[model samples]
Target: MMVEQVEVLVVGAGQAGIAMSEHLTRCAIPHLVVERSRIAERWRTGRWDALVANGPAWHDRFPGMEFAGDPEAFPGKEAVADYFVDYAAKIAAPIRCGVEVTAVRRNPNGAGFAVTTSAGDIVARHVVAATGPFQRPVIPQMVPHSAGLRQIHSADYRNPGQLPPGGVLVVGAGSSGAQIADELRQAGRQVVLSVGPHGRPPRRYRGRDFVWWLGVLNKWDAEAPPDTKHVTIAVSGAGGGKTVDFRRFAAEGITLVGRAEGFQDGVMHFAPDLAANLARGDADYLRVLDEADAWALRNGVALPTEPEARQIPPDPPCVTDPILSLDLAKEGITSILWATGYALDFGWLQLDAFDAKGRPRHQRGVSAEPGLYFLGLPWQARRGSAFIWGVWHDAKHVADHIAKLRGYLDYGAPAALEPL
Candidate 1:
């Protein structure tokens, strides 16, 4: 009923929201961050308990805050949630948890914006949609309604013990699917992983983490094409910095299937592209390694030689084999884990600033809608725009723009705030 006014309103209290909030705080911008649930809700509840950050702690640090423990060690999901909580407190972020934004629209007078939330209505001079890109779980429409089998999205999966006592079919061989299949297999469950196009990078390459090399090669800054499909890299800490590629999965006796097509007549159908997918993945992986090696050599960075050359494992023999369909009952698979990834949902945002695909039309983080902005979106400015370490630069840029717009402070170009 009553309206509250603020200089800026940031929606969502995840890593992106917190990062943007901290920057705004530094700029002395009056703003409030409202979260639908607790801070870092996805890290707290949307991930498996065994899930650790894909990258090391040092690379995952938000601006002005570093991980207190071992920098190279990967922090688990709970640890990540705690880090966000601590970071929020340390920055003194004006955040109101448990408050969900219902709708957001520009003011009729074209002054600022009107933000409707579960708590109350707020008129803000600027609104930053800091909600990360992965907002909704994308379950394939072809998934059949099987009465005997339990189906769950990767976001809802916690552990192997949660599922019934039977085999598991993990659909989609992305990072999550690969890791989940590995976890289930290690837990003594019969696991079958549906193969798909992915990037299979080794956990560590040449005494350095693959992520470190990616950083060195500035791969994170690489711009993706506008219609580029998201590719998930198969690397996890569950196996102690181990790579979870299809070859390794096959070696571990996990059944590999082709891309999941659909379910028909109580049987799951798959495309007969297993060989092509495996070949493509292998080629891409080798290309990436070659590029990294070339970059290191060009930069005159000497890599430590192994006393004994590492023996690369042979490619899995199952690539040529293709299983077109499988009856779940016959295969004894009682559960299906849909690691099919996520799609962004900005339906609540009442603005014409979005493209045809529902993504905000913004340069970096600033939108043409004036007071409207976006943060933590995939390929927003660069390849790493959606990552924890990557969002800070965009946050700083958005904060600087907001401050300048409000006539708070002139911090010159956004490039001036680049990390030292």
Candidate 2:
């Protein structure tokens, strides 16, 4: 096997990897980005058909690159993928697609890393694991295996038609879960959205998008939450975006249930916390309003005052006293969309920088293990570290560190594609 050597090796071609490449290129550092599939592969294939970026295009994009048309418009899933593809080309990123990294181990001879990939072995002075979050789709263990119910993770869900005939039970109220559930309901399918603890930010508040409010409030750079519990945000970008109101959803006949507890005797049980979950979500929304209002007062800018913190549709019966359990067959729910989210899997990287949870122990992408680095991890640096706008800062920091390494190898020529 031929061993390709480089100054730095980037293990993904997604936004983080590309941003890292851009900064490295600016710093005149030679590096190669390898991807398991094409650039922005997840955006291209993983998300559902109705998926749109949570943030508006202007906010979601990389610096100096702009998504054409309305800046506030949330780009569709395919558009986001195309944006990455175009951005990679713009930087002329030295990326090899269709090359899958199987494992990574320290170079036994001396320093750096020995990366084993599908194509061939590669040695690098430093390795940046730019594989952003969402590595593995996860369904909670509490969800039982029922013979008739087709369980689908958000990653595999493309459209409602792809699901088996009958109503849908979307368990989990995260961004993906909430959006998926709403999409199903809008398609005229019966949907029971299981509510959970979540951050509810109104799509438009005080004559500005949520992105603007977050920016003005400096919430983007806020410290990442201590816990790694999956971030469940009740916000949407469908139909030009709207405030995700579970009350309205309940009032409209979509059943709102509490968190999934367990399964017994062929029935899925839900917790009795629907009202609490809804209140928490509403509280988050109102808190945003309070902060925004305070900031306006301090700045002496008179913004439209919402006498009501936010419009709260009357609490429906489903939210107050939710259904505790439902037999899959009896409820006519043929499919269960487990938007429970993903758990990061770094099992391939033979490094000691990770905690017991398999999360890299890094101070903003710079791993404790010298040559090994991580980028685009959730809360890797700040609240924004997980998004495109924030990941660039982390990438620049990592690239700058890599630039200060002991030695620099000459830029290697691009490798020829081998027949797989």
Candidate 3:
């Protein structure tokens, strides 16, 4: 097999990779993007129906193109995947799909790097791990042994139809979990949503879409103040602007419960603070709203109008409705959907640069390892690192640095496509 030589080798060709590819290409850098599967494979394979991005259409788009839908509305998963495919082709990014990067390490001489892939080896002066946050699904061990009921992580779930007919229990109260529970209940399935400590705020307020707020506050601006603590808090937790529609979930007969604790003998256990947690989340949101309102008041900005507040309905039927104990098996929750979360797995890249947390130690996208860089990561910028609208800003910065380091022009033309 022949070796492939490039100045910069970008791994994972999703939103981040595609955006970075465009930046590199425009800057006239010699780079190649390698993806484990075809572009948007995760969105194509991992997502489910009725899966609209929790964010507004405008906020979920890549650089150069705006989302073609109503800016206030959310786009479904298919639309998102299609958008990415179009972005890739429009930019004419040079990406090799179906190429899995098995390992990555720094060049021993410290000038460049080497990557081992299923296709062949590639040596490059720079490596950018643009693999976004959802690299792998993490399931808690306590769930499997604690409950004898069926269990599936969020990754395996494509839609409510895939769930067991019995009372469907969704663990993890994040955006995905909340949305899944809402859908299950809408489908007439007995749904029980387990609310973890982390809660979500509403996407719309008083008929005003959430994106309106984000824009008014200049959350997307590149020159926004860094000390705005409230904006920081809201945007970081706004996973795709995903939040449960309490009124809809409650009206449709979905029960919100405490966090998933453990499962045993077909029993699932939950902890306390279900109501309190929800209230606290609501209060936090209201607090932020009040602050934003107050700022507008002080600065002569317009006041916010009141939308009908959707409160969590009272006394939805619980899995253990008649005051059962914390154990889930006793309540008869047959299947547990561990919607916990995703983790970024960079373990295969045996560079001794990451902290104990397995995150690459990088100043912005430039890692400590010379010629090794990363971009399109969550929180990579002051804002919008993980979202579609956010990654491009970071990508542009990283792409410039890579180009300067390689002394290449603006277009990403590889000096050689074959390995050195």
User: Best-fitting candidate, measured by TM-score?
Assistant: 2
TM-score computed on alpha carbons, candidate 3:
0.85
Worst 10 residues of 2 by lDDT: 411-420
> Largest lDDT belongs to which candidate?
2
TM-score per candidate: 0.93, 0.94, 0.85
Q: What overall lDDT, based on C-alpha atoms, would model 2 receive against the true structure?
A: 0.85
Q: What do the candidate models score in CA lDDT, each in turn?
A: 0.83, 0.85, 0.70
Off by over 4 Å in 1: 306-312, 315-317, 408-420
- Tens digit of lDDT per residue, candidate 2, span 199-226? 8988887778888899989888888555
What order do candidates take by TM-score, descending? Answer: 2, 1, 3
RMSD of every candidate to native, in Å, equals 4.9, 3.8, 4.8
User: How much is 355 displaced in model 1, in angstroms?
Assistant: 2.2
For lDDT, candidate 1 versus 2, the one ahead is 2
